[model samples]
Target: MNEGIGTTGMAGNDHYRMTVDLNVLDHLGINLYSNIAAVLTEAVANAWDADAENVEIGIDPDGKFIEIKDDGIGMSIEDMNTKYLRVGYRRRDEDQETGRTTAKGRPVMGRKGLGKLSLFSIANTIEVHSAKNGESHGLRMTIDGIHKSVQDKEPFYSPEKLPREEIQVTNGTAILLKDIKRQRLGRGATALRKRLARRFSVVGEAHGFKILIDGHPISTADRGDLPMVQFLWSFGDEEPDLSSAGQLLEREALSDRLDAWDGDWSVTGWIGTARLPKQLDSDDAGNLNSIVVFARGRLFHENILDKLNDGRLYTKYLTGQIEADFLDADDEPDIATSDRQRVQEDDPRYVQLIAFLRKQLTQVEKRWTEWRRLHEVEKAKETSPALAEWLESLPEGFRKSAETLIAKLSALPVDQDEDRKLMYRHGILAFERMKLRGSAEELAAHVHDIDKLLAILADRDSLEASLYRDIVKSRLDAIKDFQGIADDNAKESVLQKYLFDHLWLLDPAWERATASEVMETRLTTDGVLTQDMTEKERLGRVDIAYRTMAGKHIIVELKRVKRKMKLLELQEQGQTYVDKLKKILLAQGDATPNIEVVFVLGEPIDEEGSNPERLKSSMAAISPGSRIVHYDSLIRGAQEAYSEFLKKSKQLDKLERIVDRI
Candidate 1:
């Protein structure tokens, strides 16, 4: 016996009849297909090799059975024994020597002669029925029989023959597999039909070939599942002798030649990019990123995407097919891996293909990067005018980087437009900060004029401005209501509540003040203030104090908005509160406190009022740190600042109206 062959029997003349080891069938069957699609693709490829005009696949509703029938040159019993059943046959070697072509003048798609074993990947039982000439035959094979043959030490076993009455097809072959082993998820008739469509590029009436799942034909015209293609590049136009009907039309090509690589060998067919990534939804199959590799008009490798992984953003948008028939040329070494899922990645031919793809990928990446930038800019315009302005403000270097980032973000796993907006907004603020940092003089001035300078510090065009403006306007409204207070006691309490949140209404300088806590009990204990008087006669006196960033203690005394004030009386009352605060600090042995007192009275003395000049002198003569402010004065400054901002604002009017309604 030969090393790779086995003797099944002896002829009468003493010649040994050869057969493959039964273990070869088991090995090929289990390792051949990763899924039902691969198995069905093998059957379809065999039909194409036989010059089939129509191949139909039927899936049983219960999912336990499938039928693959083809209208082709069916095999007689002798042809089946010698050719169809031969394992590991070198069909390409025979075809090259004989110059064999199918009846339709189509190149055969089968190589390695292992496609028949793919049937066992899905089912335990296979029933094959074929007819040649006027005679018909039927046979059944099972996994158990193959196992029994190996156990019995039988080198090979032949399928049982069926009488003419058992034959179902008259001029072709029908293969039925029942009791399927591993059904693919969502493997129904419709899904199978779509997979078939993606797996083959030459299934059409124009090529005199048709494929149907159930009754639905997988037609090239049915492009509903395909991504929206933008450009096509064909590689086979250089030599007419090597061209086939399956090659893309010259009119459809973006370029007649693939300029990335100039060599004796080049791949022919078409590769294209979608307008957008097809994997933009979780339900998407991620087919658009694949470059399906075909040989002899059938998918030999599903994708070469992994080989050209240059970390480019454009790869997500790419999807197409390239038939590198030179890979299977007689002179080339057999580089296809045993499972047929991929070829040897290290093969010189494949390395060349990958190198060429890397260069081509860069071209598409640049194009896609530009497309995405324009697309996102337009979307920002529709979503937010401010965002559009911010995007345009980006410097050229940074803008190009942002465009590349946008092109790389996956649209799937979740919605991406909202994510894009978030990233864009953050980028805008960061760039604005960087630009502002470059101006040392402006940054120095911002410390003293923070309220007026916020437009430069903050990203004013950002949508967050709407929220900040609403807050400021609401505080203004609360302060306006304070002007109508008549009772001193009621007015004092109302002012405390309003001023706590509306510190900006008093003076923008107080925006960073700590929340106020009442110190009435402490003041009373220090003997600097009295708490026994009536709430009315007491004038609702409350001492609210806070420490500044420089550690200076400040006391704020509130008077009713309607109360008339004498400058001398206001000064006297503030002096008592400041004295008490100083005593408490000294008693605790704290660092000598630098404290200031502020009197927020209802009104300032009028010029027409008695001794107005004397009142002004009285206030000026008080402790240097003590100052008097009218309620009207505090509100006026706040109102003026807000009015100036609103006058300059274009997009914040909505915030103004919302505050008015509040």
Candidate 2:
């Protein structure tokens, strides 16, 4: 059928006609590709097939269009109608005598002749201009027009020809895309450069192929990962240059062969692990925690790392590329999926590749663990010399276990170096405590045994004193936080919340435990505990509550920082709480319930018209264990109590120094 619909001063026979099946366009173009990068890769691959030396991509954010211009042997009007516009044109079969290579002796990257259709996946309209052999042609294709043709059941669709004045480039072809599907180019040109750079292997000066975005040429550095690679391993004949790996490289295994399936299959590429998993993550270039597979210099599989199912810890920091041209060899069956983003898992070649990768990962895991362990130990020692001395003091067997523990801590994906150092400091203290308990091996095996470490901290022996030192240091930090709040003149409830959870802040000896819910409920119901406050008390008042610790009941009343109450009023408040609690305990069949009332006030008591000693004595008479403490005195007393223990506990001197450094 003659599908020509426009006259461009050329002969009617030279008009462009596309005789593609409507179903093929829907299957391979409109619904096949998913993202801009994937669709753009197809165009770049086409440029490679055309033997393009320089391909420049210009993205116009304001114009809402993308222009890809290449310098290559462009097609004339005759070649456009017979080959360029033809569907399912197999270049390999048509040019078998030339071995599917371009005039420049480079293997072509196009085979199915369907890549042009992928343009429809991203752009609603496409414009093409090309010139060669003293003749040039331009044509435009719209998705809406194709859809209309499909609805009309037309046998062929003819694209509108561009006039001679619209032909801009004279030596190569330029394709302009408009009405893009995406709302915004995610991560912008920098990210696009990195992604495109990673997809092709022959995109540098040596290969004489260049792909530029905006004005900058994409090079190996645009891959955005080699500098972070601490360890690398290469397979097959070619070993990639590691000079870009910089001084971070600790070791490398180059030119290693994958001798599988009787050596019939051949692949080339290198895999590497970064020093930290965070190094593999990028705000612009996306995650590098993958092993992308490429065939015939084009991405075949986005990532085969997940398919290998290697559950080792090293995988998070792993990334690499494997070039297996045999997967796309002309003599072999097609193993690539329809979209060409991945390979068929059921294919025997892919199955074999997975098996080989798993075996290689095992070796990588072993080496990665050992190298990380040595590196972590050195870093820990540099951060804390006392920790280094502690490690050196250990016996040969214990020292080896400690090193392994350090390695495990380093690989924990903790983002901050200071946080990691804190973990190391605590880990050493737990290790020492475990050693005294003769369970050091358990600590080494289960480094995250928080409950076991807590049990050790609860013990009060000299051997476990180092853990106590760490606990005291943490409590001191909490006190410092509380001091900041009080200095800011925070609300009474804010201070109450802090003290209710951390009873040790009041008394270092009083650790928090499960309070009797029944007693609290009874106190609330009997009006002994109330949220309501009088107008005078609303300015500031003490909230009374009780908690049980170490077989003793302690009732704490937190007063506002601005409150000023007389000692008699404080005495009366303590007496009421004591009397009500005794009645409840007596009802619960305990006549001798040991209760202590601690009144924590922001301001000192109003000891008016009475001796301070006698007023205190009378208050003590009412509640035998009652005591009034100013906020400053309470904090000072707790600090002194812990500081006294730290000074006297000479055995924890080394641990104290390590904790200080952390």
Candidate 3:
């Protein structure tokens, strides 16, 4: 059952089961340590384990060193050599199994061992000093930049921390890193500080610690600066996650909620924020793209972000602390490593802990959504000016066209651009706006503005609107109103009203109110359904012919029918006409013009309440000459409306015909 689950590029001698990869380490140093907060996290983790009450960090951009000092129980010379020097040493489990619990019997915090390597990712050289067990000492470590200076060579050696530079330390640990790498500061460094503060909320307790960067102290609480935080579940006293092989044997006591072996230390520190400021740039993170992971006073993964299978929708908002104290060696059944270092996810204990993390995250997000609604309003001022302006200018065609569009836009309010996956690449939203991506409707409203601008250039607004009625607006409005009506009879009533009063608003071609000419459409042989489409309705009308010899032909086809089913039988009637016409025209050798089809229902059938399966099942055949109308609305009484006294006659005549036909 025990199988290898990590990196497979084992390059050292064959016998060395835990051989280190110099290439990976070198890559990790350059690629992973890309953030200021991550580097600070490593330093703070050390402080937490040392029983440090406070930790302070100072960043000096011009100077070479970034110093972090903590008031923790310092290290002795022997602990440094045996423990600190050994890479991949799994000793936390033994410590926890025996001496894992704190004075309060709380499980430990440090696990998953690889924190310090990330420091090398940021700085080439580091210096350390610790005063613990009533003794004080200082030690220095150099990354040997000269060797790493080569073009792609992975050296076999590790970071060098020698005794030559050692001095007896007092009651704390102070470390300094030289040649620092910053992810993104100066631009949004303050944001990163807040991020760090939000992620490590567990620190600064017991012997509370303080973390500083560039001489600025990170805020201990970000619930104020953050958008919304919803509590899903909090960690309570529990056993640690452990593994013999790989098959997880969960415990029996907890509720069916989710089983987590590790006891809760501090799962606090998550911060969910509203849509960010518009000026989001890659340069914002500087070099760090992800948060760092720690295990047993050591480093595990740096720049480890939400990847495939991570499956958390709001994972970008996931900034917090994960406690792994139970994995210590002193705990029963052992939760950690041989070195009391880090938690292994393969270890059944860690998996159970992750399940708990996933569950808790779901809760946080659920509550966060409610919180998002309330606080998201305050940040409206932070909306991108370009975005805000674009949305404001949406319906700018001829005075008629633009206003019509605006009216429609107002109905479906959108304030965010949720899906920005291809926005930048497609040049829809520039990279700047994309970086600060929000809800989709908000972005669509901006795109709608661009369409208006294009309309203005086309002089479509030449048509004046005495009553603010643009044909496009009228048409769009008609669709909305049509979609709103529940009954077909009410729809007939609305259409009759269109004949007189709103007649002028319609296109000149459709303005004439007459039941005299019936438009006949035909779709025939060349109808080929797309192979990729599996559903039957995917086999749709290949052609539609709107025959109007006197006025313009406005071809309308029922492409969408959410209320009824697609009447494929209607297409049969259309096909017969098309075949007869083609033969007649072919025999006479007469030239025929092409007519574009406007799906009565639209091409993208709306999403809110569409059941493609049901729609597909409803496409039965129909007879020739029978009209298949997608939308039909009538104005109450166009020019004849003033004659309300003759309501009975009017109803008997045009109204009866319309009602019976419908």
Candidate 4:
């Protein structure tokens, strides 16, 4: 087959030689594109270069083939031999009369002329048919045949002639690709339309060009993100018709020109941010978090957004296009790489373009943040009237800080509106507290500091009622655990461990404190308190510990749950702790000290002669600020105190209901 096709001419008595190294096809063709969409872009670009008004693409997934037909100025026999088949053909260099544009006055997209070879990347067999000026011709090329020619060390390979009946088009060109590589067609027809729509800016009637995928003409709507655009900014004379952007378009900024190098270069096109970043994500079309760059209406770089290195929070939601035709000017050096997916980074034109885009991105980020804040504020106002009243009640300076805080919360990547509303509620609470305390300036300065903002919201006085409510809820849960342990008849040591860890159970006001470790160590040391205990007292003792909180030293004594003791015995132990702690403090140069002791026992004191009330009074007189609390009362008292706080905090109840509504 190799020898049979090696000598065949393209047409009757029309000998055409494809003079080139067969090895170059590997880099320029077979390895050029990895997907059907990328390969079809080259075909569409070729059609654009041919001044085709309408390019139709047909997908035949079942038939394992694709047909791209273009009603353009198709190549004649000699034009094919010299331009179509010739590798490294520089159309711009040869067509000096027409210059950089076609006869129809559209800038030509084909430069290196290697786009024709990209066809071989997807299909094993290719058939080309064209008609021009009352002449029709056809040729067929195969991967196997090209390989055979390469193996045979042939200088040139000729494509086999196609029968006249195979030339279906009478005024344009038709390319049929057979034996397609599997999974190259992408997700589906709709996905293909969107992908193609995003790649070219000239796929509309305004440019005298149109692309039809499976009989459906590609339109700007296929880009899929226009309706989701919340804010848009355009550069250059042409402002895109954003009416289709719908009600979501909150703002649009237009500029007449984007100049670089003293007007030696210029750019046009618009950058837009979606209402939500997820709006730009798709399983079919992939992430649209990119700023596509085009030159002469063809995609020059897939995404310069990454190259810009703008790591602002707003960049994730950005997707747009910039047309810098100067990147491909005939007067300047070609800056595009071989695949045209990127430009040479060091090129002066690209550097200046990056600079210009960075400036534009900065402006867009500023507007995007403000617009997002305004939008969130309106939504928040609509959700809760109380929140609206709260916002309006703030002074000018405080209101701005509150708005920024709410906006930052809204910008979180959380998906649910309820979660964002909850965050906004807490943010407002924190802001109000800060405002009351004259910390409005501090709130404004650290608006973006999430940790500091959280700290403010969690502060005890930020929303005192709400903070206490949360604390009450948590304490109730702990109380339940303590009751379960008592009901289970756990060991005395187990009960002691639970009580020591949760000192608040004994007294609602007591909390773990940052007491001096040295003082605590000295008080709990063996010689300090152990020397005072009798052998029988030591047998029943589980733990005796010291904690300082609320500016008072507290000593907690945990006794065996089964042990029974009198109020006189409890008063003696309490007095010992008080005297010992005072002496320790005096030895360290302190004269006076505040101290309290808590005795947690499983049973009440065994009073013999007098009633329980008389015993309690005598014990209180003996140990001043000390008390004997049974384990059951300890848990019950903690629960009742918190439950009572929850019941009485009417303001927090109202705030919680408002937040839930939001």
Candidate 5:
């Protein structure tokens, strides 16, 4: 049976007639060209296969007509009828394997003969005029004519011939499509030119190929319009280096392992990240975050960068292309999808190609992390005066260690504000950690700093450390404010507020403290420590309570900043509070409640006061940890500590203001 035979009624000549279903042509035509660019690309490919040195595409401003003209070997009427009109014709079968190249020795870019139908995708009527050997032939193909042929049980359309006057060129073909269905946007020509540049890499005089859209030729120079490539990696044998354009470029080969695929399969290309995300115009073609894949010099896919699944923040700022010609090899199955928009994910070559890309992408991610970290350190030095001073304060050896810690913190991919704040906090921690490095017990107690730094590197967080860190920062601001207060009551109020919000400020060890009570708040209306304290406990209380990790009890008392006290009176009050605390702890079944009391006063006690000598002896007789700190000395020490903290945490300009509010 003939290939075109159909199960139709027999003709009058007693032969079964062949027929085609009209719906097939309609479906293909309607679905083929989703946009005007797709149809134009197919026409250009056909021209490439025809050995055309130049293909001119012209579109009417309003999109009423489109014409694709090529200077190549023109098809005669016989060739058009036998080959061009045959749907799905195999071009490879027409000639020997060597015939895969045109007369000009260009590898044929067309395979299935369906490219001719692409003209129908955009317009209903297509006029084809051609000349070969001084003889000209022409035909007009209309969608209505094809439908009529199908209804008439005809297997193919019989195109009507046109007069010779319409054949303008010699030895070439021109296809004019009229009655366009879609209106062209004013920017369509420019957009199409850019897309065409990205879609085909073999264009330019080097290959004797040129595609002109609306008289504007798309040349290799158009590649310059791509994003600013800070660093480029060339991953194949002698692949073209990106136009330097005065940017630093890193060229290298694909790792031998990833390139070790069988059957001469290899992926070759360069991937580059923009210095900034918005450096590239993001439109229909691609954004900064795009990696186009080309097979046989034609785009098989775009935006494959997003498919790598490597969670590098810098990936969103990348743009490049990879050419895997093996996917389009002669013996390989067509892995490209029907729309030419992407490749079949399950194709073995595609799977291997993605695997290779993943490996390379991971390397790219690591390199970006290092680059950004170094950049952040540079930024910190430029923006933070405090950090500069802190760095100077370090000894040569410790300075190097501090620099390493800063780099680690800067590399964290946190938000802009948090990232800088973390750098600052870690800076202080780094200094402290180094200072206590020799004291094993002290270092362990303050290991939160070291732990937080490591947690950030691991993309985790130590919530307790962060909480106490914030408390310290805010309390530092409060202490600064308290230093400004000269009024006795006002200083007391500020001190109380500061201590209430952050008891850990006096000592980070207090971060584990269970409760805090102002001594006066425990006094009842009857002037006794009541069994159950009421809201009146707020009347006065300067005590903050702490139970160490080892279960030893501690109490801290605050005195008015400007108040002077008698040594005996202070001792009597302290002994009374201690007695009450002991009764409470002992009643809870503790055979011994190891207790320590600290008195934080605003001024030094009268040095020549009565019993001053006795007071000093009694204080030494009591717990050695018990001590008195004048408010002035305490505020000065706190200020100096925070100043050191500020210097160490150099990039904390934003966090400084935020903490001041607290």
Candidate 6:
């Protein structure tokens, strides 16, 4: 059989063994790592491989250069030759005998034999210098699109090897990517600092590694320093010791490793977010997720996310990393990779591992759901004082985000039935904060600001209508509350006019998500929603009691009033209100409601009862389940309830007259 071909393989057959084009790393070298901080992530990963205690990456965007230096076990010439110097050649497992990995209890993270290729992805050249065991080596290589050019001789495919260079330090790894790609600043990019902060923040101060991007040191990731086996069910390392199957085996197998700080973790868990359409959540190249599987503190598998398509690891809401320290970086013989980047199904050990993972995933699912519920409560707490007072005070950024949150809440569609989008949106904030709880690291990234909200409203993500409405609603809430504070009739008139214009004044009280059957009765082509005889919804006059999930008063409206309508003849409006109250009693769900209603006028400005006949007929035409009342009656009732409104209006008028005289 040909070494390159498997069993009569055709050129297109995936079975054909082929190396990934140096172009992958080549593309990544300059394009993917174009941002200074992104390139630093690679350097940080490498430093972890070197068992570095500290690493720093710096950039001079104007100078167009980047430098990364690390204090780690620097490389010997032979080590450099077999590893760094030889592309695709790695003796990582063999190096275990050298005892570099054990002290850290983690093997090196670079195995693909090709990550260094990424250096060239962003820069034209990479200069490297290092020393170890009293020996030193330094070298430099230029990409020059060498990976792209094919040679007429020598078969045209070989990785470059740099021999030696002038050295300075006794023992350390320093790399400079000259002619580096970075975000331009000033007229070019004022955002370099922020983008850098986002990228290397994961390479935080954890374990022994301390990394910095540009001038700012990386902050700890939420889960940084989380022990490998904290709170996990433990089983002793007698892998073959379990003598039975089922629950008994599970219980018996979860014994702790003798020296495992918290005991060797035996349970492995998988948790995922729900699947949505590609339009909503794309997994395409542009949106590809890289599942970094760390073994011995190195990325053994970079894009394993594509493999977990069993619909488990790829959930949009799912967050976590697949972890196992003992599993070899090479998941082969025992595990295999298909041309599709999927895991081999028949691999027994891999299957066993996954099966074990699935079981643990069950626990993980439970944990995540618990996390989700708590998350929802936390988010709800942000809005409601009861929930707010229950939770601890938030950090500065969160407190500062109150207005944004109000805007978000205002734009939300009535939470009718199950509003998945609202839940998901709030879930994002909740999950983020929940993870941040007790996290020593302040969030390094920018909080979603008011502009971001406006941008989102402008871009119209799935929350387009609601987000926009929320923004308007937030402003309304602020003004209305203030209007009530003044308790003046003039202010009340302003508030009333605002509510009429927004139409959200009719929203369910308590701000609980609500639903209404909107029937449009346009007298013109403009398509105004009105109460017409066309009668799409079968509604009758009744009480509009609506209990709120959020506490507040429910407001209901009878679409429009008719001039000759008998029910709201101003004389009968109160009785009609009582009748509607009786009607709302019948349409009960599990939800008992808090409700109110208004008889709107067809000719709102009409005199002699504000278009009485039409109003009466419309009020009479009210849905039987609805709690309804006359528009005129409501105004009268409100004024009666708050006589202060009338007094304040008179006072304001007097004050205006006095000021005019002055």
Best-fitting candidate, measured by TM-score? 4
The better-scoring model by lDDT among 3 and 5 is 5
**Best model number under lDDT:** 2
Q: Tens-digit lDDT track for model 2 on 474-515? A: 777877887777776666668877877777777766674657
Off by over 4 Å in 1: 1-20, 95-100, 182-186, 221-225, 228-264, 274-287, 391-420, 435-662
Model 6 lDDT per residue over 245-313, tens place: 111211212322223222333323222332111221221112212333434443334444445454532
Residue pairs with colliding backbones in model 5 are 518-541, 518-542, 518-543, 519-541, 519-542, 520-540, 521-540
* Candidate lDDT values, in order: 0.63, 0.78, 0.42, 0.77, 0.65, 0.43
| Alpha-carbon deviation at 598 in model 2, angstroms | 28
User: TM-score for model 4?
Assistant: 0.68
Worst 10 residues of 5 by lDDT: 439-448
Count of clashes in candidate 5: 7
Considering summed lDDT, which 10 consecutive residues are worst modelled in model 1? 240-249
Steric clash pairs (candidate 4): none
* All candidates: TM-score: 0.58, 0.68, 0.42, 0.68, 0.59, 0.40
State the lDDT of candidate 3 residue by residue for 533-652, as single tens digits: 233345543233344425323333333333343335434534444445445445546445232223333223332147644333333222222333234322222223223323322323
Model 1 TM-score is 0.58
Candidate 5, residue 575: the lDDT equals: 70
lDDT (10s digit) by residue, model 5, range 186-228: 2477777777787786787777899998888987546543437
Estimate the lDDT of model 2. Answer: 0.78
| lDDT (Cα, 0-100) at 45 in candidate 6 | 65
